[model samples]
Target: MLEIKNIVKQYANHRALDDVSTRVEQGSIFGLLGPNGAGKTSLIRIINQITAPDSGEVFFDGQPLSPDHIGRIGYLPEERGLYKKMEIGEQMLYLAQLKGLSKQEATSRIKHWFEKMEMQSWWHKKVEDLSKGMQQKVQFVATVVHQPDLIILDEPFTGFDPVNVNIIKEEILSLNRNGATIIFSTHRMESVEELCDSIVLINKSKKILDGKVREIKKAYRTNTYRVEHLSHDVQLASVEGLFAIESREDKGENTALTIKIAAGRTINDVLAHLLPIVQIHELKEIIPSIHDIFVQQVTTKASNPLISEQE
Candidate 1:
């Protein structure tokens, strides 16, 4: 639904986005991940047309990005943007109309969302009167009330308890299920792992990684496996060629081991060696989490070495 081609943006001395490019597939949850000052916001701003890219092109739904596509995109920025003095319903009506919604349609959607969010009593309340979480809920309502084709969410889970976070998360999923392509930008790797089908990692104003979540994790796998077995006295130190035990934990009656299979060695080889010595209870390959992958990639490419690994 969205294609960013070699987008470049600069601000005075620093380059916020440097030749960055990625695609957001239609009806899919795409993650835009990075640490502080990693050019994620710059790319997002360029997509929103808040600032023009120094060079390169962006295409929306097969055409060049332009003002006509503005109403088809929904953006919920990390920084809250609400008129604190205005009534919740009134403010939402104005924002919706600004996104090209008619008065009657905007009012109906506002009512539907307020009722869905159990905020019916809050319609007449001013933004200044609500707590931070309540205000976030209102902003979320404003974002999706128009049901745009493309939704861009930045740090969308901020300022909310777990319950409310889940509420908003479910709503995001519901929106995607109904055919909205979502670009979810956040430092929360767990959310990316759970919600994103594909992701692109940006660091130091460049695109570092991009692919399906499963495929990326597969590419990073190192043949490591976790095993839990009933064997206290088992010793594999003498077996040098099959595998290397990375870690071992004792659980009273059982022992858990993390081992990396050596070159030319297979799971069957490790099992063959262990089956006689221990009664295997559980065994599974250890796949790297998105958090681990994020840190590894960013730190590996970082020249500063002190970059914040904000997974």
Candidate 2:
């Protein structure tokens, strides 16, 4: 339910976002992916109205982004901070009220969150006494307590241990399930694969890719397959439309082979031609991970000294 349209932002000698555009669907988790200096933060700030873009516009739901939309969005930045002397429950209540909740409502919501996240015991503790990860949990609670229609989280899993990471992940999924749309930004491509329905990858201030996660993975399919069969010994080249035998292993009972399809041919073509000589057993196609696609695409876009380090 957010649309970033041809947005551009410039700071002194650097152009941060350059005509970047993407759409995030309502009630779905959308991933905002980019390496350092890829203008991702610029676009996020514009969406939050923390910084104005030099040109272009953002649409929230069906309307142009406006001050009224502020209460409908929640943002969690990478940096975590809390009032050192403030009690966790008190701070959370204060922040929730600022998001338009009444004191009673804030108190109720904070209690639920504290219980769900298993932080009820820490509610009376001062922020200064909390660990880094604990403070992150507090920040997350404060950010989304009002249940905004759109939630933007940058590096949300940074300080979370694996168990806590899964906790946050489940909470995010729950929010989306309750009709909130999410814009998640992180360096972890695996999380994107798990959480995002769609994603946009920005590199050098450009939208290099945007598509449904499954569709994007399908587009990058290598046409590589793993096959296992009990067969007569045969020449590898005899099969038509088979590019190469990428790997082979001889088990005592059955032989397994990894094969690549020739360009512009279907797996069926290989199977049909090979089934005559070999007793077919199993076949599976290989698909590239989002991380693989991210690295490959961004790497080909630039030759800068630091671009190689981007992923």
Candidate 3:
């Protein structure tokens, strides 16, 4: 539903974004990931039209992004911005109307959201009177009341307790299930693993990785496997084809081992030799986590110019 094409942005002495391009599909949760000062916020601003890129273009729903598209997009910035002195109900109503909802419609939606979020008693309380988490809830309500087609959330779980975080997470997933395209930006790799259908990782003002989460993880696999076997006297410590024995744990009467296979040896090859030595209980591949891939990519880009260019 959204396409960012070779967007470039520069400040006086630094390039914030350099030839970054990625796409977010319709009704999908897309993750925009990067560390601090990695140009993620700069790109988000460009998408929200809070700032223009130095070069390139953004397209929404198969057309060039325009002013009219603003009403179809909902943005919840990393930095919270709310009228501190305004009552919760009043602020949400005003913001919803500004997004093109009629006054009556805004009020009805606000009431429904408040009831759903269990904030009915806090309606008349000013934003300043609420806790950070409470204020965050209010801002979230304001963001989605108009039911925009695209919702861009930056650090959306900030200031939320675990309970409230789960609540918002459920809401975000519900929104996606109801046909909203979501762009989630955060440093939480675990959240990306759980919620994002696909992800784009940016570093040093460039797009480093972009793909379906499962595909990316599978692409980065290192042929690691975890094995559990019923063995009390077996000591196959000098396995020749093993790259490394990552870990060994004693589980009751059996031993569990995580081993990495050397190049050119398959898991079946390893199992063939192990089955004669011990009764195999369970075996599973060790999939790389998103954090592992992020660190590996960033480090590789910084150290290897050829790899970076090829990537």
Candidate 4:
């Protein structure tokens, strides 16, 4: 649904983005990931037309992005903005109208969202009277009331409690199911794992990784496995073909071990030898988490400046 091509942005001597490019598929939740000052906000601003890139282009639905496309996109910026004195319903209706909805249309949509989000009783309350989480819900409703084709959510669950978080998560899934494309940006890697179909990781003003979540995890695999067995003597020394033991801990009657396989051995081969020696309970591959991948990529880039230069 969206394509960012070779976008570059500079401010004085610093480059916020350097020829970064990525695609957002229709009806899919796409993750935009990076550490602080990684140019994530810069790219997001460019996409929203809050700022223009120094060079390159952004395309929406195969055409060059422009002001006319603004109404089709909903943006919830990381910095929350709401009129403190405005009533919940009034504020939402105003924002919806700004997105090009007629007053009657906005009221209808706002009413539906307020009811669906269980905020019907809070409609008359002022923004300042609500809790942080409650205010977040108000902003969320305001963002989607216009039924934008693309929704850009930055740190969407920032102040939400677990219950409300789950509520929003379900709504996001429902939105996707109903044909709204999502570009989710957050520091919470666990959320990415749960919701994103694909992701793009940027660091030091450049795109370092981009692919399907499962494919990226598979490509980053280290041939490590978490094995649980009844015996405690399943040490690295006792296990044949084990290159190294990453960690070991006791879990009730079973001892869990994370071991790296030797170069010439496979996980199945290692398991074959281990199964005979110990009563195996569980064995699973240790897939790297998005947090691990982020750290690994950013740290490696920082340590090797030449690598980023080459890219």
- Candidate 3 stretches greater than 4 Å from native: 242-244, 302-311
Question: TM-scores of the models, in the given order?
Answer: 0.95, 0.91, 0.94, 0.92
List model 4 lDDT by residue over 140-223, tens digit each.
988788888999999999899999999999999999899999999999999999999999988889988888898888777788
What lDDT does candidate 2 reach at residue 56? 95
| Model 1 CA lDDT for position 6 | 84
Tell me the TM-score of model 4. 0.92
Residue by residue across 1-311, what tens digits does model 1's lDDT show?
99889888889999888887788898999999989999988888888999999999999999999999999989999998999899988999999999988999999999999999999999889999999899889999998999999999999999899999899999999999999999999988999999999999888888888888988888878899998888656655526788888898888888888999998989999888888877889999999999998998878853322232332
Q: What does candidate 2's lDDT look like per residue over 1-311, in tens digits?
A: 88888888999999898888788998899999989999998888899999999999999887999999999999999887689999888888888988999999999999998998889899889999988899999999988999899999999998789999999999999999999999999999999999999999898887788878998888777788888887465644534555588888886567788888888988888888877877767887878999998998878864323222323
Error of 3 at 1 (Å): 0.5
Model 1 / residue 48 / CA error / Å:
0.9
Looking at model 1, the pairs that clash are none
Answer with 2 or 3, whichever has the higher lDDT. 3
Model 4: runs farther than 4 Å from truth? 232-243, 302-311
lDDT of 2 at 237: 54
Runs in model 2 deviating more than 4 A are 230-240, 249-255, 301-311
Candidate 4: the clashing residue pairs are none
In candidate 3, which residue pairs get closer than 3 Å at backbone N, Cα or C atoms, i.e. clash?
none
